[model samples]
Target: MHATVSDHRSDVAVLHLRGELDADTAGQLSAALAGLLERPVPRIVVDLTGLKFCDSVGLSAFITSKQVISARGGWLSFAGANPFLAQLMETVGLSRYFAIFPEVDDAIAAAQI
Candidate 1:
């Protein structure tokens, strides 16, 4: 997988991910997320529009990120997940843990960083 980050407004960071997020690529996502953790409230919207697949490792990465950021009063949101992936998250009971949006702007707006 590939992770690219951009600032939205002056506070929110958008992390756009592409390809597959699995064990091999989870580290990249973690690294990208780590860069944004320096912010006081680390509001982040993960753009998943380009992401094609995600395995358990991918899920772990997100979980870890949320844990670290939540400790610092930051929040993590996900956007643009495909329908199948959205359902999968719901089925796995992860939807309640993470804020998932149909689009990036929605996540950013909801987070209101």
Candidate 2:
């Protein structure tokens, strides 16, 4: 998978991810998210609109990112997940842990609130 980071406003960071999020790309995702946490962004929105697939490794990366953000008193949410990915998260019992939104704007608005 490919990842891009963008600073949105002062306290929020946006991560735009594309391609398949499988084991081969999970490390990159983790590193990218870790780098984002290095700064003091109170909120992070992960945009998965371009993402095609996600595996257990990818899910773990999100979990790790969430843990890091939470430890720093920040929050992380997911946006634009396709139905398949959303189903995977639900099946894995991770939907409750993440603030999943149907749109990026909704995720951002939720974070801002």
Candidate 3:
């Protein structure tokens, strides 16, 4: 998987991810998230529009990042997840932990609030 980050505003960071997020690529996601969390921005929106697949490792990455961000009084959100992945998240009982949006703009706006 590939992770690219951009600043939506002074306080929110947007991470756009593409490709499959599995064991081999989970570390990349983790590192990218870690880098973002290290910055001054406290709100994060992870865009999964281009992501084609995600395994348990990817789920772990998301959960761990949320924990780290929340511990620092930050917030993490998600956007552009496909139906299958969305169902997977709900089935796995992870939907409660994240605010998922249909588009990146919506997520960014919510994070700003």
Our tally of clashes for model 3 stands at: 0
Kindly give the number of clashing pairs for every candidate: 0, 0, 0
List model 2 lDDT by residue over 59-80, tens digit each: 9888878888888899988899
lDDT of 3 by residue, 1-113 (tens): 89999987788888999999999999999889888889653689889899989999999988988887888899988899999888988999888989999999999888656
Ranking by lDDT: 1, 3, 2
What is the lDDT of every predicted structure here? 0.89, 0.87, 0.88
What value of lDDT does candidate 3 attain over all alpha carbons? 0.88
**For residues 8-34, could you state the per-residue lDDT of candidate 1 as single tens digits?**
988889999999998899899888988
Model 3: lowest-lDDT 10 consecutive positions: 33-42
lDDT of 1 at 25: 90
Which residue ranges in model 2 land beyond 4 Å of their true spot?
none
In terms of TM-score, which candidate is strongest? 3
Query: Model 2, clash count?
Result: 0
Off by over 4 Å in 1: none
Q: Which predicted model would earn the best lDDT?
A: 1
